[model samples]
Target: MEKEIYSLRSQFEIGLVTDTLVMLLDRGARVPLIADMPQVIPMLRGLLEGGLRHRHVYCRDTDGVYTEVVVFKERYDLELIESASQIRHFNRVLAKDSTL
Candidate 1:
């Protein structure tokens, strides 16, 4: 299992392109694994919901599926980060547009 994202808040938005799952654990939030390749979706499914809300991002590929997960919380349990999903840099922009 790999850790992709941690410490995501309610207002957090992200653009994910890989198989990922974020779990809000008693300790905090954690992504069990973000496959180095998107082909490993099935391997990460079971671990995705270990008593936590797992937000999975996926797109249908030509042959199969690709996914990435995001867990919502205050902190992450993982000690080291090997990879990361693209953080949504447009939260503030979207917020501004919503006011109009």
Candidate 2:
């Protein structure tokens, strides 16, 4: 059987980050596993002064004080891959959007 790859894009508080993972189906159930989390926050920030706004974008401290991680979700898996690309097609898309 052929395997399907699903890209996962997360809306982190620090910034936007993307990762590629594989989706496995077992007994008609779908499961996903991440392969990488390429740090695209800096690159994304350059495009927009603020950051990506998403409902899931949040911060969670692990070790307490100075350690945290942001989370984001998307409807389609392909969108994640597209957002991960370094091409930067939508440069300054939020340049004027004060809300960010």
Which candidate has the highest lDDT of all?
Answer: 1
- Candidate 1 least-lDDT 10 residues: 8-17
Residue-by-residue lDDT tens digits, candidate 2, 1-100: 2223233342222323323211111111122122123343333335343444442221222211111224343221222222423223222222222234
Q: Could you give the C-alpha RMSD of every candidate to the true structure, in order shown?
A: 14.4, 16.6
Error of 1 at 76 (Å): 26
Model 1: C-alpha RMSD to truth?
14.4
Clashing pairs in 2: 11-72
| Candidate with the greatest TM-score versus the true structure | 1
Tens digit of per-residue lDDT, candidate 1, span 1-100: 2324323221112222223333222112242223222323333344344433444433222222233233335322223222333223223333454465
**Cα lDDT over the full model 1:** 0.30
lDDT of each: 0.30, 0.27
**Model 1 residue 21 CA deviation in Å:** 5.9
**TM-score for each model:** 0.19, 0.18
